[model samples]
Target: MTYKNEQLSEEKVFKDPVHRYVHVRDRVIWDLIATPEFQRLRRIKQLGTTNLTFHGAEHSRFNHSLGVYEIVRRIINMFEDRPHWNKEERLLSLCAALLHDLGHGPFSHSFEKVFKLDHEQFTQRIIVGDTTINQILEKVSPGFSQKVADVIGKTYKDKLVVSLISSQIDADRMDYLIRDAYFTGVSYGHFDMERIMRVMRPIDDQVVIKSTGMHAVEDYIMSRYQMYWQVYFHPVTRSAEVILTKILHRAKELFEDGNYTFKLEPVHFISFFNGDVKLDEYLKLDESIVQYYFQLWQDEDDEILRDLSERFINRRLFKYVEFNPNLQMKEWMKLYKLFQYAGIDPEYYLVVDSSSDLPYDFYRPGEEGERLPIHLLMPDGSLKELSRHSDIVEAISGKKRTDHKLYFPKDRIEELEDKQLVKQIKQILYGQGEVENVR
Candidate 1:
């Protein structure tokens, strides 16, 4: 049998905590799962550094990728005999979904922010480059690898297939939401996923929910919204991320200085620190490898590098206070100057981090990074944008919310021998003995 038509003799099932079971019967899929590049995901965390915050959140990208694949598989099964669902693109969709997060590195956002790398770009490169994944894809047919890349890249001619993987309510988000919720042991990410899937209809170029499932869709949207604030954007988790990012920054700064002696050479990070990472070099660095480097740097001579490493390794995370950048610029500047005077590098010690999301939005022409809005397939076979049809959705749609926190080590500030300076700093962070938290 041709690889395209090949099926396994027996269905291989993975016992999944969230999906119950991920079934694999196709030989191509089974083979893709066994590829070295795909296996690399097993070493990368699904929620980078979040395990520190939520002890149960140690799940890996491999886990999330499989959930995505299974979701798309179930979706395709429902779409097999339905209109506007191209069965010809089934394998392409499955392949894209399975390998969608193939390029994520260890501590993905920190590395991306520090090195200016885009995981999605790396994902496409892995598919098209001279890798085993590319070889397996090409075995199905010539240029099949590129087709999968385009699907993941959102540049494919088949918009319906693209929507399955990249839309506002795609399989990726659906899987990550419930799966992250499951692993993190949170109740907020739970929603009527099965009902939403049941009512999904493949329109000309998008998937629309049956109006009967509008409530389920609203639940899903709210689940995503809450998950962001309560878990993904938890201040403690961001504090961990802040330290991780600062570690990378310090390493790169030391690398550029060109005179730092290393107890153990940062061979895995040399290319990343230089901002000229190749695919092979990129693949070699994962969470385990990065953690090893972080461990070694804990003993380094550079004070900033050593302190940040020890803090991250030993869980001495920074404490945060809500300081609105717009209104507190003067306060921030004063604190920055005081930190420098107190012998701490404000550039590394005093940092502000922000997270923002627009729960839902209808399309606005000529906007940057525009997200397509969810649509409801009305009873009369007409389409209506979700917000217009549901009061719950309308209330939150197109409303962008941002949360900002200034992260600093409260320990250092509290331990300041200059008690008067410590008092002054505390007053700015905590006005009237209470944090000015912005929710």
Candidate 2:
């Protein structure tokens, strides 16, 4: 049997809370899942620091990857007998969905920011480079590895296949919304996914929802909207992320300084500190390894490193005040110096984190990463862009919203010897002398 057509005598099933049962029939997919690189995903958290907020969000990328693969599997199965859907692209789409998140490291956002790395680029490297995933794909066909990479990269010749995994409403988003919601124990990500999938139709290199499924599509869009603000961009979660990012920055700074010494040498981070991380070195990092370094750094002589590590390890996150940097530069600068005078290291303790979303967007020809707008296959045998028919989607379409918060250790501020300094900081933050009891 050819590698693409190779099937297990009995389908292997992974019992998933989100999808119920993820069935694996293709030998290549089953073998790929067994690879050490893919197995490493089990160690990486799906929601990163979100578990700190939503306690139940301890699910890993291994869970999410499998969910995504199952989603695409069902999607392709529905498309199998439809016109304009290439039967040959079935394996390619499934493979891309399964391995799309393979390159994500532990605490992905913070690590990528401090180290100047891109997980998507790493994903492509894993698929096309000398990795086990590449070998598996190459075993299927000589050029299949590159083809998988292209799909993840969104540069594949088949836009239909690319849309299945990378587009705004693709399998990746569909799976994560429900999976993350399930693990986070939130109601915001729930939608009629089965109904939406049933109405999915491929036309002219893109997938469209039938007009009859428009309500289901709206619910999915609204669910995404609520999930973004309620869970994905929760302020408390961002606080933890801020501390995590500062911890990484402090470690790198201490490593660069000639005077400081670490209790445990950060062998895994040396290349990252030097800004020349190789793929092998990158692959070696996971949350456990990072936590190990954080634990050791908590005992280090560097005060900043020690304190930040203690905070992150113990869930002592910074409190935040809403502030727009673009409009409040002068206030931000004043707060910066006040933090220094108050004996707080502004660099590590004070941070501005921003989260933005273009909840639904139609194609803007010249824009980078322009989404192919969701289309509704009307009963009249015509296609209509999503916003044109759905009033709720139209209101949010093409609109971008951003929220920025200035994070600081409120506990340290409260302990200041000079109550006057604390009062002034409160005045700047609250616009009045009174500080609200809100954390």
Candidate 3:
């Protein structure tokens, strides 16, 4: 329980843009990050294909993970003598913060979509299984690894501790919201994090914002709302995702047809195509490995695979236009045939992309997967649900902001060799000579 034994011989610092610096004085935290498992994060992008849109968003999960750890370190510092927040829980929170994204693979969201892999499960494996993370965790105590894993799993029984890492507005979200905004260069994620931390108080089982800090809480909510629409749900990012999805689809088809011979078989992709990938192989993958395959596939004999990979790597993103979702089936068929007649592959080049997100929603009586409502402690010691207090949250609750876009290659259409067919297809998409401005 003494501080001297836990201190490192010299301070260690990781230069970070979000947290400014990730300082380490404990040997345990340092060793865990050095593990091959943790080092793999360097190859995994924090925002996935968002880089295709925001060129500056090339920061990795390694950056965000360290930022989260630093935020948790600060939160723990606020609890030095607070009730319900034992000083002993400090290391567990830090460990949970560092390992939260341990299982995230290359192009995380797209990979999870195609392979049905859960990064959370892999996180637990790295912590409790026979791995370097597990070994370092066990050094503190035989059962410490499980404890850290439980916190990440939100099964640690201490709601205050769980809230620090996994809450609706905890260290993870706080760090990422600002960190992502910083990298993406957006104004939506600038909240008063220092003020929020200053006002945080550990309650009976969960951490609550003090009544005096309600404005800060409202600012956080608005920031999240802006980020969800402005960055996380950007249409250009979705265009890249659409292209990535098509690439996987084409690769799977080639693998099935046996018409293609890869210079090297995408061994990592095989299990994904087969719908059963193992953890070790998943760990072996990162953005680099995926990009390596993408680079080689650009030369593939299969036109679809070659074209999709080229578009992804070269950032020839799909162009999008506002779409009407309630159109008749006949209209859909007409558009498909029009695209085909224009010599464009309707399957690969034409897509309808729709995205929806609710910034804040109060728990409904019969709602499933309902989030635990955020509460603000009133000056009189009574608690009020966030929506009941903040009109901004009330306006946002139950309102799902959705965007529908029809994607196509405008460059290809503009250069089409068949003038008449191009004219017809253009007419189907744009009534006369101009596309509809749905915005």
Candidate 2 vs candidate 3: the lDDT winner is 2
Which parts of model 1 have CA positions greater than 4 angstroms off? Answer: 432-439
The per-model lDDT (C-alpha) reads 0.92, 0.91, 0.84
Question: Which ranking of candidates, highest lDDT first?
Answer: 1, 2, 3
Off by over 4 Å in 3: 1-5, 327-330, 433-439
The best candidate in terms of lDDT:
1
Q: Per-residue lDDT tens digits of candidate 3, residues 222-278? A: 999888888888999999999998898888888888877887899978877887776
* Residue 162 in candidate 3, Cα distance off native in Å: 1.7
For residues 1-439, could you state the per-residue lDDT of candidate 1 as single tens digits?
Answer: 8999899999999999999999999999999999999999999999998999999999999999999999999999998899889889999999999999999999998879989999999999999998999999999999999999999999999999999989899999999999899989999999988998999999999999999999999999999999999999999999999999999999889988998878888888898887899999999999999999899998899999999999999999999999789888878887887888788898999999999988889889889988888999988999999989899999998999999999999999988898877877787788745324311
Candidate 2 residue spans exceeding 4 A from truth = 433-439
Error of 3 at 338 (Å): 2.5
Instruction: Give candidate 1's whole-model lDDT.
Output: 0.92
After TM-score superposition, what is the CA distance of residue 92 in candidate 1 from its true location, in Å? Answer: 0.4
Q: Using TM-score, rank the candidates from best to worst.
A: 1, 2, 3
Candidate 2 — worst ten consecutive residues by lDDT sum? 430-439
